[model samples]
Target: MGIVLFALLLVAVVLLEVNDSFLNPQFYSDTLRDADIYNFALNDLPRSALDEARLIAPQYIDPSLDENPLVSAGLTTGDFVAALNRALPPEWVQDMVEQVLDEPGDYITGERDDFSTRIQAGDRVVLVVEEIKTLTRQADAYNLLFEQVIFPNIEDALETELPFGIDVTAERVAEAVRRVVPPEWVQANVEAALNAVTPYVVGETDTFEVEVQLSERVDVALEEIKSILLESDAYDLVYDEVVEPIIKDALGPTVALPFNITISRVEITDALREVAPAQWVQEQAELIVDATGQYVTQETDSLNIDIDLRDNKIAARDVLVRLAREQFDRVANDLPACSNSQLGSLVTSGLTSLPECMPSGGTAIEDQVRGVVSDTINSLQRQIEDAVDTALLAQIPDTLTFTDQTLKDQLAASGASDNADLLDDVRRIIGEGWTYTDQDLRADLLDFDSQDSVDLLDDVRSFLSDGWVFTEQDLREQIGDADPDVLAKLDDGRRIFKQARTWRFLVYFPVLILVVIIAFLGGRAWWGRVAWAAAYLTISAAAIWITFGPVYSALSGGGIDRARQEAIDSIEPNHDFANTQALIIDKAIDTGAFIIDGFAAGVATNAIIVFVIGMLILSAAIVWPRLSEYLYK
Candidate 1:
């Protein structure tokens, strides 16, 4: 009994803590918060309807329903009671009594006759008592029927219908629509209507009422606004600026597109192919940019762009105007063959409609090509940095810092005096030179054995401070001669390294304290604690693994890659290489990590609930006998 009571108390405390502290502002931000982080989660984003329901659900219990206006106006508890009393008059009460006492013969009189002598002085009192009991029973029946049948139905109907009267006005609807639409769309539309009536407008003040009546009409009005802006010619310039780039990215290579590709086709050498298959594509793009850039630079050389603007170079806009003119000159003078009939017209048209955001009087084509070149180069640079980082990490010692002194000590202890020169050669190659052989690396390690202990407390401290994980002993064992199995376990354990220690306090530590209390409070009775703790940890860990691993991996590049492949396959159904969407396919492969993380996290949380239930049953099965034995002993 004591154990059961304690368990119940502990459960109550945990529930209280979760509800009053953890859930309100944090975990239960919305039904959808956790779900948004990953899929398969309960959509907890509180809608207006859900909030209203929560407020109203508790009020259902009150018979008076005083707080609710509609309920107060209708048949509440007081009103119902009053109505019942009025319906039952003196004659109605007496009739109820006669019905309860009805008989073919005079049975009431017979009983009365038998008790006549005893009740002679109180005959009037006996008749009053019979009448009271009969009326009481009838009132009770009427009250039960009214409450259970009629009142609940009425209350439910009111609850279902009341919130509809909370009107969403026209102003509110317009405000919501304005906020929901993307900013770029709004800006583009506004620019298009430069000379026309304002693109945005509010109709009647009762926007919500209008939505209820003619919502489709509002949509048509919005479309008409957009169409009017398009007719004004102001939108033509802004639309072209935004749509051209979007089309280029989304549609891939197309002859129908306005832009012409004059790639300086180059022969692919064996050396170039070995280094980069995309080299031809990159070189061609760069050549096109350089040709245009040189032409503009020469043509604009004599033209003085404001020296103040050049010298100060305060804003991007200041540099852009000058650069555009330079690019225009470079394209016309340096690349004679690059000029097209459309180049002059496009530049003139583009500049004539330049917004404050657009650059003026320069080679727009060259500027765009330059941006493309810069993007491609930047991407290549990042790839190089990533590759170098991977290589550098593989090379570094996790525990011991390398130096001449350490190297000399290692060499002396190895007892390879004949190969002292060989040691020097290996060190010189790996430590000082750009390249190293496998033999050289292995020979250097021959001197390092299991017995050597290197202190790495500083490294561990740094890792901890930086929200990473490394321990002195763990580092030593990994870098030194730890057993392969031990190292593997340590490696597997390192998964927790990236977790924010601060978050652990908020999410896991409270549950941990409860686990400890449950396990140890009853003198080494660990069954319940072990089972529940293991279950919780398993679920949490699984959630982390799925969120950060396989699901994340699947969602990352995998989904994108699949989409790309589908796109590519459509392009050329039979030709394997030609059928894939090259750009999207590349991106999918590159960005797999992020997508997989979100998917995995959601799956893991759902799995935890199922696992916890199983653990509870197992806890009961294992602990019951042990508990009984402990009590008996």
Candidate 2:
């Protein structure tokens, strides 16, 4: 009977341990609530999901499009994943998990009908789109696009398409000059000249006294012309017909020349200067000033007239004659001698030889000078503008101030209208983020029993259906035509799991009664009974220590790690989905190991408590005989 009872007692101990460790709802609740498990699912699971989504994203992009649409919108794969992670935050997953586990018993009994209703998966999609929009709206986001794509392309276009080393043409030079110094300003100065020269041209002052200075070349030419006239065969005719008349005109028609007497060249030059064409001189002076002003600043628009009144032997008499004749025709029109054609020709020819009477060449000289000056100025301007553009472009890659509107405007100006239009489309997509409601999602995604809707939401629903969103109905459909016996066994396990909550105490009470009965049957005296109880407690404690301490540690120490590695190794290599699955398996194993370690520690603690209590009782039993004898004395 004692042996039978001891066996029965051992059986009860085993049942009690099984009930507390496995069947108790509190055990499962505590394990599920373990911080390591909660955090692992919260952080690791979503990370794996995001990693898988990233690998799958490229496959989903439309093949016809030349590039990824998100890339066009300035979103990198990493950026999109970050935004998605933000949208479906870890806390959101934690809340959902907590809701599902709120009543572990309901789950144990398979009675929880609200698991699918805890958090709508479509809400996560909407959140993801909205989060992407928020990211795109940031000023820094535009900088990324500008730096990585738009600005570099624009720089290349400028280098290739723009005329950096512009051809220096006359027309282009004139345009550059006009841009810096407007034609209107030149015309205004010309009008001022007209005012200054009007008095002289209309002959308001014929006897006007003026000091004249001449350039060295002009002075030599004038002296030579005077000598040629003095030695010419027509010298007497010129004196009688042109020189004396010009002197008479200057001296109020009263001045007379002593002809038959030799007239000095100095007197002739002096007489001619009195009747010089002030109007023509003023006009020539204005042209020179205008040309010079284009390149150099002029202090005053004034003319200095110079003529040499000296004797010099004529070297080129014919050339001097020709120059004098041209000037004579221009200034001697109103002179009496100029009425005689032959004599007028001689006097004009003589006057033309003077430097003061040289032709101004209209605008030919001015245009040439203007062209050279303009070309220089334009080249410099082009270089400066290019440098500034390059500097601004370089800064764009790092600075956040380069906004979307600015980028759009630049792209449009650079003839990238297509890219500009794409930017607008991206902005529109971001601005109109996540417009669908729950009803929309239900009609589009959840109500798949009816005709399938073909839209963005529907596509999203299809993608998520692969792994994320599923219902109990889905599971039932997947379990279609399974063995009836297996189904019955599953049902039976669930029923037992539910009943074990209350029935756990029945097992506990029976184990307690068995322990007491075993102690009573194994001993007679009170000390013996105490010793027997101590023995049972010590044995049970030793069994627990051996099973949960060294033995359990040895079995589980590297087993979880090995299982985790094996699970990971089982996945196909070089595949994103498989890699993500491996991560899930790896973290799940870690969480399970953490919970198991906690359970083992709790069991060891309980064993240690039982052993201490048993030793204390044994000590009391050993001292009881001596104490009782002392009491009897």
Candidate 3:
């Protein structure tokens, strides 16, 4: 009976102490604050993550050279101008500008090949402006020529003296004058006559009737005034006395000065150049400008441009421009038909229409072209940023997942295929396949997962956003030269994290009450019974601590800082795994170390709880005799 009772008490002690050490929630919760346990888990992270990370891709979580290809694109305005000209060609641009200039007001109403077709359909302003300008120029030229040259010459000729004699009659003198006239002069006169007759020739007028009437009138004049008109001496005397003075006084001031005025054709042209188009004409020009701008703006907005992964710059515009410019420059050395100044103008003209900010002679098109490309680049920047974010986020996976295929490919890419042990070691550490996610990333490594990439990837945010960062790490030791197979066991052993919380503190309280009740009923000597029960509990609790110490120590990586850094070497940089590798390794070390330390703390807490409970049981046993004596009295 005594032996049986002792065994029952021993079972009760084991239940109370052993459960607290290995399966108690209160102990494990406190263990989270344990520094030594956290340090141990922290040491396991880098090796654990890389062992899984190496197989995937560098771009997924790593920063790679390929992602920054735009760094070398180096596009400037000059390059843009050069490349755009080649792609679109300056000749096409020049001709298009000429066409645009010549177009009429109603673009849609004109011929397809005409300038009007190049403008917006609703634009008729350009045509109206051009027409008014052309008419104004004609009117100015006519006024300059007639007022300064033709009118004066005619007035002067009308005042010239005529000889009068029996043989040198008016008609005879006129014939002599005609014979003396230069043949070229005569031809010129004939041409002038033809020009005067042109309107009449094409009109509905009676040419013969007027000529016959004028002939009859001349015959009547000869019959009526033969003495003065037909007799040359008589007629000369009359003209000098009457006609010359009268004509000179009336017409000389107006027409004579013009005949004497000697002005060059160049002066006339220069004067006309000073004249600007009318206000109405300018309004029309504005419409054409608006239409062209709308078209160009639409074209630029729709332009789809992306920075190539191979371009080695922020965008493709620069590299493309540079190449085209280089080619053009090479040809330019040979004095290609176009001069430098001419080429520049052609390129500018080809780029677009004149801008509001530019003068008529300014390089608006070139500026506009640059603006368009810049707009495209700015737009692409956002998309690229978003795509990069998606790509990096994808590296973590939505569901928890990992595979050895990448690890295998990584091994082959590194030319390390000869090492058969590396693959097996990696497989043991990460397992064959595991799907992971953001939850895993945010989880504690010692608790289950030390948000694997949270440490190293934290620096990635430095470039992404201006924010705070963790900096303390001089004393935190990392695991160095650890066995993969052994660490993986630790990863599995962390399952205790879940198991420890199955029965909470409330459940354990009832069990404690039952143990005390059984101890009191089993023995009449209260001191002896409680003392033996406490001893059994203490022994059981101490056994758990002794057994778990080495396992937790191995998990903590012997307090070394670089235990499994070598494992990270297997991963290769690529599109999928692009990360700042050195920073990640360091961060992983710090994170993994801290996590293992937490686990160690939790374990120590459980040990402390068991030890404390054992001591309380022992103290209660010494007091039980006095309490029982008092109760019985």
Candidate 4:
């Protein structure tokens, strides 16, 4: 019967495992549905709708259109042809010019008048028309080239590339010069330009170039530009490292390229969608467990039997419960005792309220009683798991597998039958931690000797905490999933917890009874008996080390290094954090509380286990009188 019962227990555990796998948070069902719906909408949308909206909305300015000098001309292909035709001289003017030149004698009426003189007026009219035609032709050619190549290339380039190194423009250069040059230089330019605008002649192209002998002022402006470039590392790097090389390669000479790049800050809005749905299903399950496991694990009143026995006395279970609650009340009725040590009265004050431990009247009280017990059990389990996790987390190389192993080890560790098994379980959890995420492995990287590195880790954690918003949306669009690591961890944690709970439920009562018996009759030499007394003390000390020594050491080491480096690097060194450690004494206090809690739970549970073993020994020691009678017969 015992074997059958054990087999049934095994089967039930297996079934629970299967159910957990399917129903957990990291499961992919909901996300898959969402993905399908999103894809359908995208496929059904009209192609032209997006384009028409963009045209109406004018999302961004066309840099090419803005850069063009002829925007105001507003000339189209048709306008070019009309302008060309209008520029041609009238047929009558052309004919008159020809006739006068061919018959110079008739036009002059005198031998002294030459052909050149006769047609000079007509020649002027023809020349004006010809000049107009030439200008119109040139404009037409420019417009054709702009349409066919320059405009298209600019548009395509804008779409395909990030802003390059250099963006030189006349105004940008002028702005650079204005920023640096003295007031005297500006006054000189104003005076020089004013002096140069005299006796302007028509049809004199050379006059414009000389007017802008503006080169002398520009020379001074160039010095200001060079100075600015020299001051900016980014500018110097772009000019010397990237642009200079590219220009030298193409032009067959080393050349300095001037660039005036406009920098616009653009952000990629990441959403939490990239996590695979399979993984997500797992994460979701884990998250649910993380959020609620403590409540469920700690619910004591809901235990199969609401029974408590103390001091070798057996009364109604409810009566025992009342006695326990009363004891707790008496202890907490006054302000908690305080010591003159570190974080002294703070912990005492924090513990003054025992609402979680207090048993009110009625169902709430019943529930609270149960909750406290269950929470106690869960707390013990958590302590064991956390110890294993911390040790393993330090050793783990990856984060993805770390959480997975930690979850598994937590379940198996709870079932530990002896000291060896418990220690083995701890080691297994650490070994398994090797498989977790890069984030998990890198958690200690924050303990690096640099605040900058620590800050980077913080940023990553903050990003995760913020739900990876940008990636989430993209995942929604691309594959239809949300980030699932947290959810998966929660799911695995819950399943392991539930398994552990089930085992505890099956064993707790029998174990408690047996422990009671052993405590009654077991000899002093029983080490199991010794375990009950010392389990908490050992665990409590370990917790203290974890909370105070290790944690403090990790944080302080990094802070000190940063202070030292900054001191060395400083021109006028100020060692502000030099001797001021970042250590918080409160962490040690918290550790103390944690140790107390761990001790309470471990001692209580082990007492039951030891009691069971003690009872068996006592039974053997009593020598079953019936067995002696049978032996004599």
Q: In TM-score terms, which candidate is top?
A: 2
| Tens digits of per-residue lDDT for model 3, 84-165 | 3333443443443344333321122222212212322111222333333333332333333333444444444434332222
Please give the clash total of every predicted structure, in order. Answer: 41, 10, 76, 59
Best by lDDT: 2
Model 2, clash count?
A: 10
TM-score of each: 0.15, 0.40, 0.22, 0.15
Between candidates 3 and 4, the one scoring higher on TM-score is: 3
Q: How high is the CA lDDT of each candidate model?
A: 0.34, 0.47, 0.38, 0.35
- Runs in model 1 deviating more than 4 A are 1-196, 199-600
Distance (Å) between predicted and true CA of 429, model 2? Answer: 18
Score candidate 2 by TM-score against the native: 0.40
lDDT per residue for candidate 2 within 281-362, as digits (tens), equals 3343333223322211212222222222122112222333333333434433322321234333433443212122222124
lDDT of 2: 0.47
The predicted structure with the larger lDDT, 3 or 4, is: 3
By lDDT rank, best first, the candidates go 2, 3, 4, 1
* Cα shift from native, residue 595, model 1 (Å): 7.6
Candidate RMSDs in Å, in order, are 43.9, 28.9, 45.6, 59.2
Candidate 1 structure quality by residue, lDDT tens digits, 1-633: 234333433343334333332323222223223223211111111122222333453256465433443232233343333333344333444433333333201222221111111101122223433343334333343333334444455444333311102223333334344433433443333333321211111111111110111222334434433333333332221212222222233333331200111111011111112232244333432332233222222321221111011111122222323333343334333432324544444445443221122122257675664344335434444433343233222222222122233323333434434344464444333233323233333344454632121123223223323323323444445645856776555444443321322232344345456545644553344565565445444454444445445655666665666765665556654332331234334444433433334334443443454346545655674778789899999
Model 4, stretches more than 4 Å misplaced? Answer: 1-73, 76-92, 95-98, 101-117, 121-209, 213-633
| Clashing pairs for predicted structure model 2, backbone only | 323-352, 323-353, 324-348, 324-349, 324-350, 324-352, 324-353, 325-348, 325-349, 328-348
Give, for candidate 4, the lowest lDDT window spanning 10 residues: 263-272
lDDT of 1 at 242: 22
Query: lDDT of candidate 4?
Result: 0.35
